[model samples]
Target: MAFEYAPAPESRSVVDIRESYGLFIDGEFADGAGGRIKTVNPATEEVLSEVVEADAADVDRAVAAARRAYDRVWGPMPGRERAKYLYRIARIVQERARELAVLESIDNGKPIRESRDVDVPLVAAHFFYYAGWADKLGYAGFGPDPKPVGVAGQVIPWNFPLLMLAWKIAPALACGNTVVLKPAETTPLTALAFAEICQQAELPAGVVNIVTGAGETGRLLVEHPGVDKVAFTGSTEVGKQIARSVAGTRKRVTLELGGKAANIVFDDAPIDQAVEGIVNGIFFNQGHVCCAGSRLLVQESIADDLLAALKRRMSLLRVGDPLDKNTDVGAINSAAQLERVRQLSELGTSEGAERWSAPCELPERGFWFAPTIFTGVSQAHRIAREEIFGPVLSVLTFRTPAEAVEKANNTPYGLSAGIWTEKGSRILAIADKLRAGVVWANTFNKFDPASPFGGYKESGYGREGGRHGLEAYLAK
Candidate 1:
């Protein structure tokens, strides 16, 4: 009989949700064009809050505010003063970490453990890491004195709400650029909370303005003539649109987009560790991650053993409430996202791939899907070719290292990839051949603020951490 763990739900009292949230602009909360969208908790499908939707005019207002702050307030501020503001923001985040984590889990549909441990902590660390760079950017390899890029328009996705906010805002502020940011429609609560943190930090008015809305709002922000830089993290389709929008203009742009990353395992790899990596690579954050290793390429010599072990490990994962401390897999971000996963999984089976899912029970009320995998998947299958953005894995086998490399690089994305092997020589050799921005050998899904993160090719361009991250916001 399988062992059952008792429920350990995190208390929701830590976070105080307001009835209706307004757009955060110019160091204050302002209403939109009278349209409000209800933000729902994906775990219970309950309305969490009504968020203001920014119309084109609202976007214009935000851009104007950010520009004013850039020219009159933030732009002339000394690096030491800027660093002080960043440090204050970081301290506030750490102090209210529990509240932010609870709010994030409720809004994002990620497990409490992840929001509390991975996302929230990293968000704080990102600000803290970049804060130290505010006064030292001259030493960041560009030159002795670098200039700010003026106003930056940033759009972050829903997968990792506050974390992505940090990735965009921290570096921009650290480099002395004021910002106008838009959070994804599905998850805007944490970003809103972050605006409050900015208020607590006493950041100069309009140095960081958050305009919350749907795609139209983001489009307007990206195309605004006042914006000197554009940083976007979302689907590749939208990234291309933003790229075209800035084609004839002098506005700088950086995009961090989609992926269908491959996790390759050789015959000589440690089976248990590889299994853990496989689970983490695809199942982390419900596989909504763009860098998720959704495609698995395994050597044929150990294919059967690895598959058996992977299946055994998967069966033990707990999938349920996002607030549950012990939950391994949380609900899909929304109904639309759940549908996308269902469509791709059905396509996989119809295309002759064998499908398997963990025997874990799913909640009846919310948007949920079991952790699933497809074996005997071909390179042509939709599940293997596209980004499902859910907890689904595609397994493909290879007989040679060359075949593994070819299979891993088959996709248009070059965001991230993983290789599992105990042989150091083969690992280094394979690492040299893979065309991914970040490659993990032996470990997977680990991230730190000191390390630069981004992608190559269609997966998008520019770096988001370390010294390299500051370059995008600094004058060349």
Candidate 2:
């Protein structure tokens, strides 16, 4: 007889969600000139809170505040002093990790285990990592006197909300620049909680400012004349718009955009391990990852066996409440995202691909998607070429390593890819030939604070997460 598991839902009482949230400008919560946006929980479709939608005027105010902070406080502050503030923030993140994790799971619809174990811990690690580099940047080979780029305008996506914020903000601050960031409208709660963290750290006013809103507010924030640097993480279409908007200007920009990464498995690869990596690659965070391995390329010899194993594993995935500790997949981030996933999946079937999904019951009220995969997928198919950004995998068969490389690089994106084999020489050789910014061998979606990450081609430019990341926020 199989073991039946009881409910082990994480308590929501750890977090205190506010009824309404305001913009975080100049180190305090303030009313925005624009209207309000209600953020809902994707798991239950429950209205979490209404946040002020910052406007062009709010952007102007935030930039002014950031400029003042740059000129008078943060920029002139010594590196050692800045390190102290960053370290303090890191400690505070660790102290309140549980609260932050619960809040993230509530607002973002990621599994509680992921929010607590992966997301929140990485947030603290980033602060600590950048803090160490704060006083030692001269040793980083950026020269004896690397200077700040004044005010930075950063915009983060709903996926990995706080971690994305850390990716953009940590290194910028370590280099002594002030920032004004805007979080995605649907998942602004955690960023606001981070704002309170900033206050708790007693960070100087305007050192870090968070403005909550949708696309329009982000447009205003990034295009403001006062910003010296702009960083964005979202879709490729919007990234191109920002690039065009910043053209012929003095402002520097770094875009971490969309991806349709490939996970290549050779005949000699460990079948069981590759299956697990495949699951983690596409289904982690319900496939919202920019570098998610949505394209699975399996050698023709092992393709059938791999597919069988993958299907069996997918059948075991638990798709339900975000707060459920045993859940493997959680809700889609929003209604629009859910629709996109559905439309693309429908297109996959209509385009002559065979579709299969995990047998799991999803909550009727919330935004949810079962883990799915499509076989007989061709490189010419829209599902193989475009970024689905959902828990949908498109499997393609390759006969040789060269063909695998060709098929993997066929997409316009080159953010990340994975290679699975036991041979070290093959791993090195294949990784060298791949066009992605990061390649994982025998594993996927592994990250570290010391390792730099980004993308190539339309996946966007510039690096984040390490010493290389600091250069984007520093002046030459």
* lDDT (Cα atoms) of all candidates against the true structure: 0.93, 0.94
Clashing pairs in 2: none
Task: Give per-residue CA lDDT, model 2, range 44-157, as digits (tens).
Answer: 999999999998988998999999999999999999999999999999999999999989988999999999999999999999999999989888888898999999999999
Task: Judge candidate 2 against the unseen true structure and give its global Cα lDDT, from 0 to 1.
Answer: 0.94
Clashes (candidate 2): 0
Clashes of each: 0, 0
Model 2 alpha-carbon drift over 4 Å, by segment: none
lDDT of 1 by residue, 304-416 (tens): 99999999999999999999999999989999999989998999999999999999889889999999999989999989989999999999999999999999999899999
TM-score of each: 0.99, 0.99
- How well does candidate 1 score on lDDT at residue 257? 96
Error of 2 at 112 (Å): 0.5
